[model samples]
Target: MQRRGLLLILSSPSGAGKSTLARRLMGWDPTIRFSVSATTRAPRPGEEDGREYYFRSRAQFEAMIADQQMLEHAEVFGNLYGSPRGPVEAAMAEGRDTLFDIDWQGGQQIRNSALGRDVVSVFVLPPSIAELDRRLRGRAQDSEEVIAGRMAKSRDEISHWAEYDYVLVNDDIDRSFKQLQTILEAERMRRDRQPALTDFVRGLNREFEQR
Candidate 1:
Protein backbone atom coordinates (compact mmCIF):
# COMPACT_ATOMS: atom_id res chain seq x y z
CA MET A 1 0.00 0.00 0.00
CA GLN A 2 1.24 3.47 -0.76
CA ARG A 3 1.94 5.59 2.31
CA ARG A 4 -0.33 8.59 2.70
CA GLY A 5 1.54 11.58 4.03
CA LEU A 6 1.34 12.69 7.66
CA LEU A 7 1.27 16.30 8.79
CA LEU A 8 4.52 17.19 10.60
CA ILE A 9 4.24 20.28 12.79
CA LEU A 10 7.42 21.55 14.42
CA SER A 11 7.37 24.41 16.90
CA SER A 12 9.86 25.87 19.35
CA PRO A 13 10.81 28.81 21.48
CA SER A 14 13.24 31.40 20.10
CA GLY A 15 16.71 29.97 19.35
CA ALA A 16 15.65 26.35 19.91
CA GLY A 17 16.67 25.35 16.33
CA LYS A 18 13.28 24.11 15.07
CA SER A 19 13.64 26.16 11.87
CA THR A 20 17.12 24.81 11.19
CA LEU A 21 15.98 21.21 11.66
CA ALA A 22 12.88 21.80 9.52
CA ARG A 23 15.03 23.17 6.70
CA ARG A 24 17.25 20.11 6.90
CA LEU A 25 14.26 17.76 6.85
CA MET A 26 12.88 19.40 3.71
CA GLY A 27 16.26 19.26 1.99
CA TRP A 28 16.72 15.56 2.71
CA ASP A 29 13.16 14.44 2.00
CA PRO A 30 11.43 15.34 -1.26
CA THR A 31 8.05 14.09 -0.02
CA ILE A 32 7.81 16.74 2.72
CA ARG A 33 6.16 20.04 1.71
CA PHE A 34 6.34 23.24 3.77
CA SER A 35 3.18 25.05 4.88
CA VAL A 36 3.97 28.70 4.15
CA SER A 37 1.97 31.09 6.33
CA ALA A 38 0.43 34.45 5.43
CA THR A 39 1.28 37.49 7.52
CA THR A 40 0.26 41.14 7.70
CA ARG A 41 3.76 42.14 8.72
CA ALA A 42 5.95 43.96 6.21
CA PRO A 43 8.81 42.06 4.68
CA ARG A 44 12.18 42.50 6.29
CA PRO A 45 15.08 44.13 4.41
CA GLY A 46 15.82 41.22 2.07
CA GLU A 47 12.77 39.03 2.55
CA GLU A 48 10.81 38.04 -0.56
CA ASP A 49 7.07 37.73 -0.96
CA GLY A 50 5.56 34.19 -1.21
CA ARG A 51 8.95 32.60 -0.54
CA GLU A 52 9.60 33.96 2.92
CA TYR A 53 5.90 34.53 3.65
CA TYR A 54 2.67 35.32 1.91
CA PHE A 55 2.46 38.99 2.82
CA ARG A 56 -1.15 40.20 2.91
CA SER A 57 -2.99 43.37 3.79
CA ARG A 58 -4.68 43.64 7.14
CA ALA A 59 -8.08 43.86 5.46
CA GLN A 60 -7.44 40.76 3.35
CA PHE A 61 -6.28 38.89 6.42
CA GLU A 62 -9.37 39.93 8.37
CA ALA A 63 -11.60 38.91 5.48
CA MET A 64 -10.04 35.46 5.40
CA ILE A 65 -10.60 35.10 9.11
CA ALA A 66 -14.18 36.21 8.66
CA ASP A 67 -14.78 33.72 5.84
CA GLN A 68 -13.11 30.83 7.66
CA GLN A 69 -10.32 30.60 5.07
CA MET A 70 -7.58 30.52 7.67
CA LEU A 71 -6.75 27.40 9.66
CA GLU A 72 -5.46 29.61 12.43
CA HIS A 73 -4.83 33.34 12.97
CA ALA A 74 -3.06 35.12 15.81
CA GLU A 75 -1.25 38.32 16.62
CA VAL A 76 2.35 37.88 17.69
CA PHE A 77 4.69 40.72 18.53
CA GLY A 78 2.03 43.09 17.22
CA ASN A 79 1.92 41.49 13.74
CA LEU A 80 -0.82 39.23 12.42
CA TYR A 81 0.24 35.80 11.12
CA GLY A 82 -1.74 32.72 10.13
CA SER A 83 -1.75 29.44 8.22
CA PRO A 84 -4.12 29.07 5.29
CA ARG A 85 -6.23 25.92 5.00
CA GLY A 86 -6.52 25.35 1.24
CA PRO A 87 -2.94 24.50 0.27
CA VAL A 88 -2.37 22.34 3.34
CA GLU A 89 -5.50 20.31 2.67
CA ALA A 90 -4.57 19.92 -0.99
CA ALA A 91 -1.12 18.58 -0.17
CA MET A 92 -2.36 16.01 2.34
CA ALA A 93 -5.12 14.73 0.03
CA GLU A 94 -2.48 14.13 -2.64
CA GLY A 95 -0.28 12.07 -0.28
CA ARG A 96 2.32 14.78 0.28
CA ASP A 97 3.55 15.42 3.81
CA THR A 98 2.87 19.01 4.92
CA LEU A 99 5.21 20.57 7.46
CA PHE A 100 3.86 23.36 9.66
CA ASP A 101 6.13 25.55 11.77
CA ILE A 102 3.49 27.08 13.97
CA ASP A 103 2.84 28.01 17.57
CA TRP A 104 0.56 26.20 20.06
CA GLN A 105 -2.49 28.24 19.07
CA GLY A 106 -1.92 27.59 15.39
CA GLY A 107 -1.56 23.89 16.09
CA GLN A 108 -4.80 23.91 18.06
CA GLN A 109 -6.59 25.33 15.04
CA ILE A 110 -5.34 22.44 12.94
CA ARG A 111 -6.40 19.98 15.63
CA ASN A 112 -9.89 21.41 15.59
CA SER A 113 -10.04 20.92 11.84
CA ALA A 114 -11.08 17.64 10.15
CA LEU A 115 -7.48 16.70 9.36
CA GLY A 116 -6.40 16.45 12.98
CA ARG A 117 -5.12 12.81 13.17
CA ASP A 118 -3.15 13.41 10.00
CA VAL A 119 -0.98 15.60 12.25
CA VAL A 120 2.19 14.52 14.04
CA SER A 121 3.23 17.49 16.14
CA VAL A 122 6.71 17.97 17.62
CA PHE A 123 8.10 20.72 19.80
CA VAL A 124 11.76 21.67 20.09
CA LEU A 125 13.41 23.00 23.26
CA PRO A 126 16.74 24.61 24.02
CA PRO A 127 19.13 22.77 26.36
CA SER A 128 18.96 25.43 29.07
CA ILE A 129 17.78 28.95 29.78
CA ALA A 130 21.35 30.21 30.09
CA GLU A 131 22.32 28.54 26.83
CA LEU A 132 19.31 30.08 25.10
CA ASP A 133 20.29 33.50 26.44
CA ARG A 134 23.85 33.06 25.20
CA ARG A 135 22.65 32.09 21.72
CA LEU A 136 20.39 35.12 21.60
CA ARG A 137 23.23 37.38 22.65
CA GLY A 138 25.53 35.91 20.03
CA ARG A 139 23.23 37.11 17.25
CA ALA A 140 24.11 40.80 18.00
CA GLN A 141 20.81 41.90 16.55
CA ASP A 142 18.69 42.70 19.63
CA SER A 143 19.32 45.34 22.32
CA GLU A 144 19.47 44.35 25.97
CA GLU A 145 15.86 45.33 26.57
CA VAL A 146 14.74 43.54 23.43
CA ILE A 147 16.65 40.46 24.52
CA ALA A 148 14.87 40.56 27.86
CA GLY A 149 11.54 40.71 26.11
CA ARG A 150 12.42 37.70 23.94
CA MET A 151 13.64 35.85 27.01
CA ALA A 152 10.26 36.47 28.59
CA LYS A 153 8.47 35.18 25.52
CA SER A 154 10.75 32.17 25.39
CA ARG A 155 9.51 31.05 28.81
CA ASP A 156 5.92 31.34 27.65
CA GLU A 157 6.65 29.34 24.51
CA ILE A 158 8.54 26.62 26.31
CA SER A 159 5.73 26.21 28.78
CA HIS A 160 3.65 24.63 26.03
CA TRP A 161 6.10 21.83 25.33
CA ALA A 162 3.85 19.36 27.13
CA GLU A 163 1.16 19.99 24.53
CA TYR A 164 3.13 18.43 21.70
CA ASP A 165 3.29 14.74 20.79
CA TYR A 166 7.07 14.77 20.64
CA VAL A 167 9.67 16.97 22.33
CA LEU A 168 13.28 17.31 21.17
CA VAL A 169 16.19 18.98 22.93
CA ASN A 170 18.45 20.86 20.55
CA ASP A 171 21.77 20.81 22.30
CA ASP A 172 23.68 19.66 19.21
CA ILE A 173 22.41 20.54 15.75
CA ASP A 174 23.66 17.41 13.96
CA ARG A 175 22.46 15.08 16.68
CA SER A 176 19.15 16.88 17.06
CA PHE A 177 18.51 16.84 13.32
CA LYS A 178 19.17 13.12 13.21
CA GLN A 179 16.68 12.60 16.02
CA LEU A 180 14.06 14.61 14.09
CA GLN A 181 14.67 12.55 10.98
CA THR A 182 14.21 9.42 13.03
CA ILE A 183 10.88 10.72 14.35
CA LEU A 184 9.58 11.41 10.85
CA GLU A 185 10.72 8.04 9.62
CA ALA A 186 9.08 6.34 12.55
CA GLU A 187 5.80 8.13 12.01
CA ARG A 188 5.88 7.31 8.31
CA MET A 189 5.97 3.58 9.02
CA ARG A 190 2.89 3.45 11.23
CA ARG A 191 0.10 1.13 10.03
CA ASP A 192 -2.46 3.94 9.95
CA ARG A 193 -0.23 6.02 7.72
CA GLN A 194 -0.82 3.73 4.75
CA PRO A 195 -4.34 4.71 3.74
CA ALA A 196 -4.84 1.45 1.82
CA LEU A 197 -3.50 -0.84 4.50
CA THR A 198 -6.92 -1.82 5.73
CA ASP A 199 -8.02 -3.02 2.31
CA PHE A 200 -4.78 -4.88 1.87
CA VAL A 201 -5.21 -6.63 5.20
CA ARG A 202 -8.80 -7.50 4.38
CA GLY A 203 -7.71 -9.06 1.11
CA LEU A 204 -5.18 -11.19 2.99
CA ASN A 205 -7.92 -12.30 5.35
CA ARG A 206 -10.09 -13.33 2.40
CA GLU A 207 -7.23 -15.34 0.89
CA PHE A 208 -6.64 -17.16 4.15
CA GLU A 209 -10.33 -17.95 4.49
CA GLN A 210 -10.48 -19.35 0.96
CA ARG A 211 -7.39 -21.55 1.57
Candidate 2:
Protein backbone atom coordinates (compact mmCIF):
# COMPACT_ATOMS: atom_id res chain seq x y z
CA MET A 1 0.00 0.00 0.00
CA GLN A 2 1.20 3.49 -0.75
CA ARG A 3 1.75 5.67 2.29
CA ARG A 4 -0.18 8.87 2.83
CA GLY A 5 1.82 12.06 2.42
CA LEU A 6 3.16 14.20 5.27
CA LEU A 7 1.77 17.69 5.83
CA LEU A 8 5.01 19.67 5.92
CA ILE A 9 4.77 23.03 7.68
CA LEU A 10 7.76 25.29 7.01
CA SER A 11 7.70 28.50 9.02
CA SER A 12 10.21 31.28 9.58
CA PRO A 13 10.64 34.97 10.34
CA SER A 14 10.43 37.39 7.42
CA GLY A 15 13.61 37.27 5.27
CA ALA A 16 14.65 33.90 6.74
CA GLY A 17 14.46 32.33 3.26
CA LYS A 18 11.42 30.05 3.71
CA SER A 19 9.73 30.94 0.41
CA THR A 20 12.89 30.20 -1.57
CA LEU A 21 13.42 26.97 0.32
CA ALA A 22 9.81 25.92 -0.31
CA ARG A 23 10.02 26.52 -4.06
CA ARG A 24 13.31 24.63 -4.30
CA LEU A 25 12.09 21.69 -2.25
CA MET A 26 8.86 21.34 -4.23
CA GLY A 27 10.72 21.64 -7.53
CA TRP A 28 13.19 18.93 -6.47
CA ASP A 29 10.45 16.55 -5.32
CA PRO A 30 7.43 15.82 -7.53
CA THR A 31 5.46 13.98 -4.86
CA ILE A 32 4.81 17.14 -2.88
CA ARG A 33 1.99 19.62 -3.61
CA PHE A 34 2.38 23.17 -2.33
CA SER A 35 -0.72 24.39 -0.48
CA VAL A 36 -1.85 27.72 -1.93
CA SER A 37 -3.57 29.64 0.80
CA ALA A 38 -6.69 31.84 0.60
CA THR A 39 -6.28 35.50 1.37
CA THR A 40 -8.48 38.55 1.74
CA ARG A 41 -5.72 40.87 0.58
CA ALA A 42 -5.33 42.28 -2.90
CA PRO A 43 -2.85 40.56 -5.21
CA ARG A 44 0.42 42.23 -5.99
CA PRO A 45 1.62 42.82 -9.55
CA GLY A 46 2.18 39.48 -11.36
CA GLU A 47 0.40 37.50 -8.64
CA GLU A 48 -2.25 35.06 -9.90
CA ASP A 49 -5.33 33.57 -8.35
CA GLY A 50 -4.88 29.91 -7.25
CA ARG A 51 -1.19 30.20 -8.09
CA GLU A 52 -0.36 32.84 -5.51
CA TYR A 53 -3.53 32.59 -3.46
CA TYR A 54 -7.30 32.19 -3.71
CA PHE A 55 -7.95 35.91 -3.25
CA ARG A 56 -11.30 36.29 -1.51
CA SER A 57 -13.50 39.10 -0.21
CA ARG A 58 -13.97 39.89 3.46
CA ALA A 59 -17.46 38.42 3.37
CA GLN A 60 -16.24 35.12 1.91
CA PHE A 61 -13.39 34.96 4.37
CA GLU A 62 -15.72 35.66 7.27
CA ALA A 63 -18.14 33.01 6.00
CA MET A 64 -15.36 30.42 5.79
CA ILE A 65 -14.35 31.28 9.33
CA ALA A 66 -17.94 31.13 10.52
CA ASP A 67 -18.40 27.68 9.01
CA GLN A 68 -15.01 26.41 10.27
CA GLN A 69 -14.01 25.68 6.71
CA MET A 70 -10.49 27.03 6.97
CA LEU A 71 -7.84 24.76 8.38
CA GLU A 72 -6.05 27.75 9.84
CA HIS A 73 -6.02 31.54 9.48
CA ALA A 74 -4.34 34.67 10.83
CA GLU A 75 -4.29 38.42 10.33
CA VAL A 76 -0.86 39.60 9.21
CA PHE A 77 -0.32 43.36 8.95
CA GLY A 78 -4.12 43.88 8.69
CA ASN A 79 -4.47 41.38 5.85
CA LEU A 80 -6.32 38.09 6.30
CA TYR A 81 -4.38 34.93 5.34
CA GLY A 82 -5.59 31.38 5.72
CA SER A 83 -5.50 27.82 4.39
CA PRO A 84 -8.60 26.22 2.95
CA ARG A 85 -9.55 22.81 4.33
CA GLY A 86 -10.88 21.11 1.20
CA PRO A 87 -7.84 21.42 -1.05
CA VAL A 88 -5.48 20.15 1.61
CA GLU A 89 -7.67 17.13 2.31
CA ALA A 90 -8.03 16.34 -1.39
CA ALA A 91 -4.26 16.50 -1.93
CA MET A 92 -3.42 14.36 1.08
CA ALA A 93 -6.04 11.80 0.08
CA GLU A 94 -4.13 11.30 -3.15
CA GLY A 95 -0.98 10.46 -1.17
CA ARG A 96 0.69 13.75 -2.00
CA ASP A 97 2.51 15.77 0.63
CA THR A 98 1.07 19.23 1.41
CA LEU A 99 3.48 22.07 2.05
CA PHE A 100 2.26 24.92 4.25
CA ASP A 101 4.31 28.12 4.19
CA ILE A 102 2.71 29.64 7.25
CA ASP A 103 3.48 30.91 10.74
CA TRP A 104 3.49 29.14 14.12
CA GLN A 105 -0.04 30.14 15.09
CA GLY A 106 -1.36 28.56 11.91
CA GLY A 107 0.63 25.45 12.71
CA GLN A 108 -0.97 25.36 16.16
CA GLN A 109 -4.47 25.51 14.68
CA ILE A 110 -3.83 22.64 12.28
CA ARG A 111 -2.33 20.59 15.09
CA ASN A 112 -5.50 21.10 17.10
CA SER A 113 -7.67 19.94 14.22
CA ALA A 114 -8.08 16.47 12.68
CA LEU A 115 -5.19 17.23 10.35
CA GLY A 116 -2.80 17.63 13.27
CA ARG A 117 -1.27 14.15 13.11
CA ASP A 118 -0.46 14.63 9.43
CA VAL A 119 1.88 17.53 10.13
CA VAL A 120 5.70 17.55 10.28
CA SER A 121 6.79 21.04 11.26
CA VAL A 122 10.10 22.73 10.45
CA PHE A 123 11.12 26.23 11.51
CA VAL A 124 13.74 28.12 9.53
CA LEU A 125 16.06 30.74 11.05
CA PRO A 126 18.41 33.38 9.71
CA PRO A 127 22.20 33.31 10.31
CA SER A 128 21.95 36.49 12.40
CA ILE A 129 19.75 39.45 13.19
CA ALA A 130 21.88 41.75 11.05
CA GLU A 131 21.54 39.39 8.11
CA LEU A 132 17.76 39.28 8.58
CA ASP A 133 17.53 43.06 8.61
CA ARG A 134 19.68 43.28 5.51
CA ARG A 135 17.59 40.71 3.65
CA LEU A 136 14.32 42.53 4.40
CA ARG A 137 15.72 45.87 3.26
CA GLY A 138 17.19 44.26 0.16
CA ARG A 139 13.62 43.80 -1.14
CA ALA A 140 13.32 47.63 -1.28
CA GLN A 141 9.50 47.57 -1.25
CA ASP A 142 8.99 48.95 2.24
CA SER A 143 9.67 52.30 3.93
CA GLU A 144 12.18 52.54 6.76
CA GLU A 145 9.38 52.60 9.32
CA VAL A 146 7.75 49.51 7.79
CA ILE A 147 11.12 47.75 7.67
CA ALA A 148 11.61 48.52 11.36
CA GLY A 149 8.24 47.01 12.18
CA ARG A 150 9.07 43.82 10.24
CA MET A 151 12.39 43.53 12.11
CA ALA A 152 10.53 43.76 15.40
CA LYS A 153 8.08 41.09 14.18
CA SER A 154 11.01 38.92 13.16
CA ARG A 155 12.23 38.81 16.71
CA ASP A 156 8.79 37.71 17.89
CA GLU A 157 8.67 34.98 15.22
CA ILE A 158 12.14 33.69 16.11
CA SER A 159 11.18 33.50 19.77
CA HIS A 160 8.82 30.61 18.94
CA TRP A 161 11.66 28.37 17.72
CA ALA A 162 11.13 25.90 20.56
CA GLU A 163 7.58 25.20 19.33
CA TYR A 164 8.81 23.46 16.20
CA ASP A 165 9.89 19.83 15.97
CA TYR A 166 13.01 20.80 13.98
CA VAL A 167 14.90 24.05 13.39
CA LEU A 168 17.32 24.93 10.59
CA VAL A 169 19.57 28.01 10.55
CA ASN A 170 19.80 29.25 6.99
CA ASP A 171 23.26 30.69 6.47
CA ASP A 172 23.24 29.42 2.89
CA ILE A 173 20.16 28.79 0.74
CA ASP A 174 21.23 25.62 -1.08
CA ARG A 175 22.65 23.97 2.00
CA SER A 176 19.66 24.86 4.15
CA PHE A 177 17.25 23.57 1.49
CA LYS A 178 19.15 20.30 1.31
CA GLN A 179 18.88 20.01 5.08
CA LEU A 180 15.12 20.58 4.76
CA GLN A 181 14.89 17.93 2.05
CA THR A 182 16.73 15.46 4.27
CA ILE A 183 14.30 16.20 7.10
CA LEU A 184 11.36 15.48 4.80
CA GLU A 185 12.93 12.22 3.63
CA ALA A 186 13.48 11.06 7.20
CA GLU A 187 10.00 12.12 8.30
CA ARG A 188 8.35 10.08 5.53
CA MET A 189 10.10 6.95 6.81
CA ARG A 190 9.17 7.31 10.46
CA ARG A 191 7.62 3.92 11.50
CA ASP A 192 4.84 5.14 13.72
CA ARG A 193 3.83 7.75 11.19
CA GLN A 194 3.51 5.24 8.35
CA PRO A 195 0.71 2.94 9.40
CA ALA A 196 0.56 1.43 5.91
CA LEU A 197 3.99 -0.16 6.49
CA THR A 198 2.58 -2.32 9.25
CA ASP A 199 0.97 -4.53 6.62
CA PHE A 200 4.36 -5.20 5.09
CA VAL A 201 5.72 -6.08 8.51
CA ARG A 202 2.80 -8.49 8.97
CA GLY A 203 3.60 -10.15 5.67
CA LEU A 204 7.06 -11.05 7.02
CA ASN A 205 5.39 -13.35 9.58
CA ARG A 206 3.63 -15.32 6.84
CA GLU A 207 6.91 -15.80 4.98
CA PHE A 208 8.62 -16.89 8.19
CA GLU A 209 5.93 -19.53 8.94
CA GLN A 210 6.18 -20.84 5.37
CA ARG A 211 9.95 -21.24 5.72
Q: Pick the candidate with the highest TM-score.
A: 1
RMSD of 1: 1.7
lDDT of each: 0.88, 0.89
**Which 10-residue window of candidate 2 scores lowest in summed lDDT?**
188-197
Per residue, candidate 2 scores C-alpha lDDT tens digits across 147-178 of 98888888888888998889999999989988
lDDT of model 1 at position 124: 92
Model 2: lDDT equals 0.89
- TM per candidate: 0.92, 0.91
Query: How would you encode candidate 1's per-residue C-alpha lDDT over 125-161 as one tens digit per residue?
Result: 9999999999889978878899999998889888889
Query: Cα-based RMSD of the predictions, in order?
Result: 1.7, 1.8
Residue 100 lDDT (model 1)? 94
